[model samples]
Target: MQELLEEALATLVPSDAEQAAVAALCDSLLARARKAAPDGVEPLLVGSVAKGTWLPGADIDLFLRFPEGADLKTEGLALARAVLPDGEELYAQHPYLRGSVEGYSIDAVPCFAISDPTQPASAVDRTVFHTSWVHDNLTDAQRNDVRLAKRFLAVAGAYGAAAAVGGFSGYLVEVLVHRAGDFPAFVEKVASWRPPVALGAVPGAPEAEITLPDPVDPGRNVAAGVMRDGLARAVLAARQFLAESTADAFVVGAAERKPLGCVTTVVLPHPGGVEETALPHIQRQGRKLVRALEPFGVLGSHCSLGNEGFIVLETAVVELPERQLHRGPAVWDAGAFEFLAAYPQAPLRDGRFWALKPPRHLDIASAVQALLPKARVVEGLADGAEPLPAA
Candidate 1:
């Protein structure tokens, strides 16, 4: 296993030239941000690029530091403009500009440069502490561990915090490797992971989907963005890799195609929005779609898109009956009167009501088609978008 991991790292580790080129871009952006920054403030380089744990083709994150209680919207945007004039504006807690520079995607974010991690002025303020901690603590052996872990996750389609991936972030993987002692140990730990895997000395009921407390901020979870589906897939990957204990398992990813007998492509029209904005919107829509299909027994589903305003849902599911059970309000509730009026023959089950009514959709295709009119049906479901219903 150790030999396999070492071999993987040899190929996974970014070449010196690749790292140098990326570093130069970060240094240039940092210098530019610092130059634009006001007196007593400077730009701090952060992210995987700064910590020397980045893989090839990683984005550059340059944060302009400001004092606490500073108007980051005003100060940050101004410095971002000064550093790089042309870029797309993005928003989370505050506004930041993002664009490509020297063939590399760059985010010129402005955040509070505070010394303490506990009291972050903004959402990104704790990033400084995370970067510092990882840099200072990650050993040479552990860095390679991270490389192997990231490569494994990447191949398994369980790597990234981006809405599109919703898997593991490099930082989270680093935390896991650091906590588990090595790459192989991390895999061993993950093989035994249940749905909501918590790590790094977190307390509570482990209720928040997946809780990985930030080492810098004990109250915050670093793995909050991880979608449960992604974690499940990663867990499966870990078990499989461990069972095989081969390097090949960490390199190739085989798509799990939905059963052809009852599978379909739901091409949802896009709003032709920006990539950054459209992706999160699409991911949210995917969640909504899967939930809507749960009653019909959706075996599996995934979101895929290739063009403008184009989203596809490959879903496998059991067929919806002509009459589906719809739950009604509580017996004593005021809304129960209206609900009973809608379904006059509804049975009073316990304190609640239940009704067998005509399903809006006869099958999977029709269900998705029905969803087109109600949900974020910006452009509506595609013309041939069909849902595969199970018998």
Candidate 2:
């Protein structure tokens, strides 16, 4: 196991040359930001790079800290824009600059230099404290453990905390590794976890399937974004790794698709918005379609957003029954009269009005088209469509 972990680390950890290049990029950005900023504004390095736990090709997170009274929405964004003139402004909690520089993705975020993490003026104010906490608490060895854990989760398709991914965040991985003392121990612990797992004594924390209160801010539930299925995937991956420790465990093999029945693919234009915001919207649309297609015996679905977005759905029945007995309100209810008025020849069965109506959509493709008028619905997957992940 130790040998396998070491091999994984060899591939996971950034090379010295790569680190040097990233450091140089960070230094240049810091200089540019400081030079462009007005008095009382401090430019600081944050995120994985500053904490020394960043993976190879990790996006650089550079925050410009403004004094408490400064307007983060306006002046903060202005500062970031000034620093990266070519960069595009994207909104999350607030607007920030995003661009690619020399093959590396860069984000110049503006935040308040708040004194208290617990009393953050904005959502991102606590991030600086999180960086500090990790630096103070985790040893060099444990940082590597965090890298291993992160890669493992990524391979298992359960690494990111994005609304689309609904999985663990990098900071959460650090905290979990810190608690377990190392990567192997963390895996062992996670393999035995049941749902509704709470790790800290945080008061008034919102209930979730997995609750890990943010150590930096007890009021926040760090694992609030983690979806149950994503957590289950991580747990199963951990169990498999424990049973047979091997380097192959760190690799993401092609997803084997064993669809139960008919497959329907919906292709649509990518919703233009910040990725964090757009992805959730796309997933919600996919889920809404899935629910609508329930009568067609929906088995599962996968939604992904890129240049163009796609939603792939599997169902036991491609075509629903032509005539459906539309149930109405009970005879004793006020709505029953309205139902009878609407369906003059409706029959009364089991004390409820029933109307035999032809289904609005007989097939899955037509159903998808009806739900998403602009979407291109295919009976099976589109040509060259990516396979759905393993169940």
Candidate 3:
């Protein structure tokens, strides 16, 4: 296990040239930001690079820290735009700039650079402080453990705390590694986790399937965003990786939802006019479609970057028949008459009201499209984008 892990670290760790390039990029961004930044504002390069846990070819996160008097959004955007003129203005807790620098992706985010970590004003404001905490607690050897843990979670399809990924974050994995003492130990612990696992100084009912509290902020749940299915997959992966100890168990790839039936592709035109911003929403929308498809017996799905600038979801379910029976409450129930009235021809059978419901739509894509107008059923899809690939 140790030998395989070392091999993985060799491949996953950033190369010296890549490090130099990222450092130069960060320095350049800081240099550009200092000129346009408001008074008393500071530029800080945070994330894995700062903590020495970054992977090869990973994006750089450069944040502009502002004083209380500074308009963080405006000043940060100004600084970022000055650096990357065509940068798109994005938002999370606060507005930030996202663009490419010399073919490498960069996120120029803004946050309140507070004096104390415990007194952060916003969610992301404590990230740098968290990075510092990890750096202080982790040794050079432990950083390797973090990298191994990250790859393990990622391969298990339970990595990333993004809205789309809804799994574990690199930082969360790092904390797990620290607590468990090493990568292999971390796997052993996760493999032993019962559902609703909580780890912290104080543990109670878990807020999520597995609860791992933020070390810096005890009140905050670091694993709050992790979904049950993803965590289950990670648990399974840990067991499998323990048994196998093979590199294949830690492959860098997206986890595909297991297929249940004939796959249906839901394609939407590129929403953001650009790929990076649009792709997340596309993947998110695909997950939403899968959720909506559950009632129709859809089991799982896979999202993809479709050809011709479209976002695609190849799902595991297809359309039902043109019409189906909808069972209603008992004849004496309050809503029974209402169901009869709505269906008009609904009849009592075995003391229950039954109605032959009209089809939502004969075509699955059309059904999804019709539903989208009444409700934005998906997180990433913009209004008016249609689903495609009939039948």
Q: Which candidate is the best by lDDT?
A: 2
Sort by lDDT, top down from the best: 2, 1, 3
Give the whole-model CA lDDT for all candidates, comma-separated.
0.73, 0.86, 0.71
lDDT of 1 by residue, 156-196 (tens): 77888776677898888988899999888898898898865
Candidate 2 lDDT by residue in tens digits, 117-161: 888556677789889999999999999999999989988888899
Candidate 3 residue-wise lDDT, 1-391, digit = tens: 7788888889888888888988888888889888888778788888888888887777788888887656766676777677778887887777887888788888888788788765646777888878888888998888988877787777776788864456888788888888999888888998898778867643553467767668887767777878776688788888887777788766765334443355444556556534435667666766666676654665455444544223333444456776788889998888877887788787778999887766666655666676454322232332333332111
- Give the candidate number with the greatest TM-score: 2
Give candidate 3 misplaced runs (Cα > 4 Å).
32-39, 201-206, 254-260, 268-295, 302-363, 373-391
What clash pairs does model 2 have? Answer: none
- Kindly give the stretch of ten consecutive residues in candidate 2 with the minimal lDDT sum: 382-391
Candidate 3 accuracy as TM-score: 0.77
Off by over 4 Å in 2: 254-260, 321-360, 382-387
Question: Per-prediction count of colliding residue pairs?
Answer: 2, 0, 0
Worst 10 residues of 3 by lDDT: 382-391
